[model samples]
Target: MLEEMVRPDVVVGGYRIEKKLGAGGFGKVFLAWRDGSPCALKFIHLESVGEWGWRELFIMLRHEFPNVVKLLSHFKWPEEKPEYLVLVMEYVPGVTLYQWARDKNPCARELVEKLLPLARALKAIHAKEVKHRDLKGDNVLVREADGAPVLVDFGAGTMPGAPRVTGALAPANLRYRSPEAVAFFLRENRKRGERYDYSVKDELYALGVILYVLVTDVYPFNGPDDELMAEIRAGKPKPPHVRNSRVPPALSNLCLRLLAKAQARVPDAEALCEALEELLEEAKADPHRWEMVLCYGWTADGRTTDDAPELVGHDSQAWLRRWIRQKPKRGRPPAPPVVAPAPREPPAPPVVAPASPEPPAPPTVAPAPAEPPTASTVPPLRTRVRRAAPVLMAVVGLAVVVGLGLAHVLGKFQPPPSTPNPGQSVLTSPVPAEFSPDGPTLWATHVHEVAPPWKPSEADAGAALSKADTPAPVTTVTLSSGTTHMKKKAPGSQAERAKKGNGSTGANVLLAVAAAANMACPGAQIRKEPAPQACPAGAVETMTRQLGLRLGERHGAGMPGEKQGSSEPVPVKAGPISVELAGDWDVGTDAMGRGGRTALPNGTHLTGQLCIGEKRVYGRITQAVTPTGDTFTVCMELIGQFDDERGLEIKSDGGAIKVHPRVEVKTVDRFE
Candidate 1:
């Protein structure tokens, strides 16, 4: 049976346990107080006592890292009931990167900026002959006070020359292993005698994987152990841009290089940091090119602030209320007024009432003088006609003069109606001549039939498969919100489709013209009539149904490991991602740079879809230069359809003839 959780007032290692914050592999983490200050106490079960535990304690005690969790003190109980080991460490009052990413997956630039500090932390650990074998998102905490990232959890840590504390046969630790490390582990296991040595490269590789996940919101490789091993043997994985195209080529290339074969990858953590700093400089080089990319940071914490009064006993609710709250002041209520006896003379004065309620005297009445007939009552008819005659003549003459002047001005100023220019007509069309202004379209037919399968690392996957072990939280980040503003395309940008007479563009246009000229409705034809102004909603629905069916036939409905209708709105939080519009622009990215779809400071998700991998896919798209002046943030939702061949091609006569019909684009980001 699991050990009972310690209640408030329960003291361990001179610290009072406040509450169980969370449970980790070797023990439970609790919020505790020591010397009346908040601290974290991790209690390891006696059964978990082993060489690895002792070594982790040793590593933490001997060194300190600015970006790593600090160990304040540790103790073990031998004679105490329910024997246990307790470690007191600094309480990180910040949200885990795993939690932060759930709603606000950082883009490439943002992720790099945040991970740079972690890379330096790794360097520090490496310099001291230590390796944080488990460096996943959960192990990293961003300080709430500042956006600083701190690495935690040393359960799987090891020193360069220390004895192998973990068994070689353990498979769970292989998830983030470098290729060489994996090879060494396998070789040693096969021999049943040799040691599986880990090097700096192995840890660096894991850091690279973390970077990749942060940028793309997915693992670089996935599947069963054998499959992942095969990929490692291949010595190369798909680049980051393959999944997230917005990733700058330089950054993508750097991420790929970091994941290169053991010896080929960057030599050490210090070098990696230097490389990252250079990339950071490059990303922030151009001020005018930058745009705001909202990420997530601290929100709230379970622990109280330093100045908050501590609750002392078992009555948590009542004690907490009294501890932090002040007692209302009870001032001396006003003294009761002293009653004074009325004087005897005053009583006699009340009886001395005045007499003489005599009859009233006759009021003097004066006859009212006759009021003179006031000229204000009305003017005589003759006087009124005389006053109006001159005014009427003056008004008529003014009207006549003004009309003549206007006629003359119109005659002199009128110009002929300008004839429409051919070029103007070509440019005035709503649809572009090309489908994609950037370049050739990656047609659905030509693209891969299925997206590459992805899964958590073997270590993560194995831990997940086991019910006995409580897996560490591993949250995948995404764009937090569904609603996004639609920005107009920049001037001179190509139309949404191909240009007229430009091969595919022209062919599509011809098909549309023919369809307009030939058939007016489904299974019916009209000789000549103004184009239907509004198609019934029912008809549009039918068309959409048909289109979905055809697309389903052409391409599968969903990708592997993905579910239909699985997208849901994530809650927005304050602190970052709230922004203001520039003078010229009506909207801009969040100024604080700390929100995404999941952590919007303040806004409702009106409507939209958050899609992974498709950077350009958006129901609505807003491109704005942020205050950073180097990066352009694209706020988008994946919902509305683009004007493509699939959209233009609608069959009415059972594919007997081609038909190009006008398709009205759907309005996006709308709330009823």
Candidate 2:
């Protein structure tokens, strides 16, 4: 019930809560302000605040490093209930390391300049016999005011006398676990009682993983849990330069050294700081090589290159916008505006005289003639010509039509034949031979005289003239008989059997051949060839089989009615699966969906939500999660209803409610 009291405008002790910043497995952190300065207030339930809570408070109060967050005050809230323990600390206003690198696109030299302070902070903490077991990108903050690095979140830290707060393995992200730690876990899982100790080398390896992602914009080993573990044990990741060419060789080597598999090969905190300092000095000597930004191809003039590599987990548009805004402007600055001297004041006009007992009207002066248009205002001669071209063409076309009509009425014009003569030669110039399935064929080169005009049966002068005005004759070509000839088929032979088997196939083949011929020589007439003959017994079947094989090679192999390279999805339905809630979940609030061992596969992620109806509550599956742990975004819809064992219970936080109910889920449609 204490969760209901955590919200904006609620004062815990002396600080007023502004908004929730983030939440973890144990508690939630909120941004709050007291007097005039802002601070972070972390609220933890008494039940969940075990030894780790006290451990964090002890480390924060004892430490005085400049690069670490300082603890201010702490107290248990609400004397009556006393359900939450609120800790107030100084708030660092900035983004996480991952967000900073993505927006800034820093080069190797700038990256080292920022990360050097983090190494020194680690050294300072290690000197006091304290170990920060979890060291990932999220734990480091780039301060908004000074650009200095500050380490935060010490919930998993410990000293010499700290109590054990975890099971066999320490609390850390799975992706940042070192190879040796993973091997130890695998070897000791079957033992009755065994634990793997988290050491300095493991912390350094986690830092290396952060550096690796900053340079390449992708995880070192990414896949399912099983495959990821296997690769971490034995696989070697590619160097940073291999993934992103802009990474400097020195920086890549440093990352590799920090991630060495052997514990002794990795450097300690002090040695790592020394190495970073040396790299910084070397960067000053070769500025050009070390100043290129990693994971993005950007030009000096604030433009992205065409050959830029694809970004994995960064927003391309947002990054490009930041680059454009932060890059220095090039070219010359504008000259100062010119100012002309003030003109001399003209002498006062002579005194005006009165006439007819009234003031004389001022003499009217004619307005100056308007200035002639300048070259900039007038259209160019070429533009004028372009605008009039279509009108000129239309006039010429009308004149030609009228002249032709006049000539036809006077019996002085004659049109060419619509079809060429059989014995005429149309090829005046040499051209390559036409292509045919059998072989190449040449055109005949003989000429013939034109035939006389046709005579009309009735004496209709208009009809005779219309017939004489036909279109021009088309160009014709002839094929050699011997090259394209096929044996004639006997009556009722194999040709009849082939036609009966599949008549559409033969027709389609002829159409395809005709289309090819037309495309080869446009606007030319094609003569009809002789009919093809039938093949011998078993020959047709062999040709059909060979044709099908060729088609299958081009378009994937399948039957006549089947589609290639695709399959229909099968609908999946699960019934009344029980899921446990980690924290108080309310209606319309999305949370990670989990089910019993037999309901869903491991690693599958389902985004779940609850919606209130008039009579019952509905459960919605907003994302699609397959049995193999593949996730896809889909349209949101209600899939099933919740059991009526427990209804909605309103909390005082806002318009949200909490409830525990069993749900049934079914997939409505497959993702695209």
Candidate 3:
């Protein structure tokens, strides 16, 4: 499987395949260069990776970057052959924490001090909207140039509102996943067709594990996957410092607090980074030990004893053998002939290279044309022939009729369905219901649920994913204050938090919205500097697509191999925003041409539109501003709607783009 992924021509997209960097069960990762920049190329085994799982990731953050693993391009060429999704990302030349810890086996004081930046980098990522769900030593890579650890592998990461299944996320992820993450990862109400949505705490918790490992140089809890999963599931991981006594009490306390199944105990990654920063400052004051988290077996005493042999020989092996013999006090077993095997050389592969072009003439011995077989002359049947003559005639007639029918049917053909996702609502974004004299209006555009493994594909799934033809479906949702309510919850999902709480008091702090924000997406509210119009009036028209993000922790779609294992997401939804407003907006998604736009129903329109295939979004209201202007105080807000799709978006008051280019097709930003 890994060999098939060793592409000789293209990496996915147009990036050239260079060399294989690493291989794992799910697929192989390659170090590649594209457009004169280096990026990590992650491939997926076609048989095991699910189509939707890959689509969801493509929809969310395939190309967005800076903090997240930027998806520069994706692979599509091997469509007809045994296919693989080649994901090209910013080539980060760094040592995985596993490699780092191993290289330094016992981490030095200098190495420990170097970890401050790693935490800071993670904080920076949290500031952006991405989290590293798989935060094991292997996933946390330290840049060789700066010694900063960047989180990679979002196969298990989630934008807020993404699904979290029990088996989808790795058990290692569970080790570092926060309490909110734990609760989300282990849902009690899945029987009611409910799945826990991943939250921000997922990243926070993983950050905690990273911090613990960084400080102590040992996994917070180490064991087999199932055993560790059970321990984490059963809350058996001892406080990080307990494994290493030299670990600072404050650091230990923080690690314990992070492991605590309490929201108040474990805060968000930002807050955790602050606390760890303080702890790291203290650890720097006095550095005595090194951390070797993933590597073990080499003991501190063994080094000194091992050195003794260099100066003075010690044959304890012979002494032990003499003690074991005992018969007639026999001295050594005749010193078994030390016949060491000779070193073998690695074999070289054979190669053939021709210097000149060969002539088109080959030694061809053509066989003579085959002679036609002579028809055998037979005697014609006469009258009063066999008694079975009528049956034979009937059989011949039936054969002729069947052959004719087969020919007629074979001549005709029918085209396959264009869009597989029909009937079932394949909503790109929710169309908010209007508020009336009654209670409130809430009309949600539901996601078409994944059908059985053998079910026919959805028409829209085909159309939305199709690059050949069929325009993607688009929707215009009214963005009134009412439509800005928090995302929905899976059915009967309260049991997880309810298990720890008094039912009425709501100790489910992890269940809060903050826990599961899209780790890699732009926020729901726009954040432009110098105070952008007081966060907008009525409802802030923020834009995001239904990417495969779970914000904090991602649940499994199914088992590994059947789905991508925490490395990449597949494109499931994409769209941009179109609106008219005075406030400035910033948008981000896990896709290209996937931005947002905003425009008031009848007032000045501002669209936060994302070009679905471009993975770029920009703009604010067309305001009269200069370097010296925008000082006057004026405010006017109007209700509007947002239109979007996985690839395109459009929304405005009335004028058409054809009628007024300036009024409609204004160049906000080309953030290439």
Candidate 4:
């Protein structure tokens, strides 16, 4: 059904469908041609567009304003099924307000010029007791032909007598909700059934958000949903001038007043329009200051100079003028022609001449004639000295070598013995007093026969350790086998000497020797303490129960008689379904889906981003069309490989399912 609605060259009512324009949570919009004039055809499922929605359309038809998009006609589609409602309206060809600001880099005055008409448009609509509930940057368009702002997308609008459709709170973007509305929602959310009355103040707050984003390129209160809600309820956003100094003080103050929590503090639509007009007049008085680029490097203090080096030989002013006059070409421009150098001519062959020979003349000798003394006959003094210098140096070198050899032969040179530094003591091996060639050595004799194991008195040990060569302090532990083991004390130990009067000097020394032996001998093993015993079963069970309770509390589960949060999945019929992106996709653009069946029937829409790498479609299903042609809101992630036989799939708690593809996807970066 969505495919039939979006197919190009197909006649829908009187207008012919050209292509899809864009998609939102409720429906898909298409650019259609009627009598050679282009118009927008919005196709929304009948069930999703409530009775109040159609009434809002009637209100749009009744009230006409230059800044508001004009509604041409409305009708229900498919006489047999009658599942979708189509609204044909004048198409405003342009980029969104956000995109316009990004490209044109409008100044504070230019922004006021653009937003003034929107404020007046709001005033006109409000005169009839109608409120455009969903006002955002994306909802406002900057007309390409005349640079006029056109307010569009009044699907969430309501009149005084309109029945309630959106539950509890107004239908609006969370980022644009007023602080009072948020505070009311937080306070009343605990009640079983409560509703927050949407008012003019909330609409003005949304306008303030749009202004803040335009000036600073960021949301005033930004974070995760919960944190953002909390901030909207109680937090005070930073003023626009503080975030971006280029913003005018008057504009900044007005934006803050519009976003004030108290409803009385915010100006009505008509007052807001007057305020914008005053600001516009003030901006016109000082053209130079008001016309400076807002988002560029210019600041309130002064222009910010770039630290990067400028391109050599580039004249930016000339280039800008040339660009304005020249029409833009699509895709990458053709690379400059690369010309191969002309083949070099081979070098001309060397000229040759025929050999000419004549008989050699007899050798002739002539008497020398007296001539002036020349450089050839006698060299300069410097040249003569340079020529004789090498021979003289050779003789001197030979004499020096002979004298050194004679001195060495006479024992005049000898190397000095190595000696320790002044503060260092020389180490030497001490022979055991019991060791003798005629008797058994210490290692071969009985263990007790080695001069009673020669123990060092505490005084002697202290004196020996006082030297700089003392090893790190060690602790001796006596084991059950009557063997003592020594280990280095932990670092940062305050005691430098052993405990007084322990009288275990011999054991300590012996333990130190054993420890050194153990380190030096890799194969040696010192007994390690036994492994820790396993915990009792009762203790293990108790820990497990406590851990489960903590985890249950953290996850908001496992407690008896507690109701689950609204976000929990609800049961839905499971079956195979096919879907594809609702419109053309490209990198750095948002992508929406439109096809489904059975579990998610035809006309179901998805919202997501079209990323570059892997060419996969990523997003979630925001609204689902039922098999009976009804629609309901849903949150499920849509993920799958692009162009694969399995197609794209929606990952839900129900199960993974596929959506068959129908059309080839493409994108356009520029247009005529």
Off by over 4 Å in 3: 1-14, 24-26, 33-37, 45-67, 79-82, 105-115, 121-129, 160-174, 177-190, 215-218, 222-230, 233-236, 287-672
95: Cα error in model 3, Å: 2.3
Point out where model 1 deviates above 4 Å.
Answer: 1-5, 78-82, 160-166, 169-173, 287-672
Candidate 2 residue pairs in clash (backbone atoms < 3 Å): none
Error of 2 at 525 (Å): 91
The clash count for each model shown is 24, 0, 99, 3
1 versus 4: better lDDT goes to: 4
The CA lDDT of each predicted structure is: 0.42, 0.46, 0.35, 0.46
- Put down candidate 1 lDDT per residue, 155-208, tens digits, no spaces: 667875554654552222333567776665445235655555667887788777
Best by TM-score: 2
Candidate 1 residue-wise lDDT at 287: 28
Model 4 vs. true fold: TM: 0.49
Indicate the worst ten consecutive residues by lDDT in candidate 2: 443-452
Scored against the true structure, residue 586 in model 3 reaches a CA lDDT of 19
Error of 3 at 478 (Å): 48
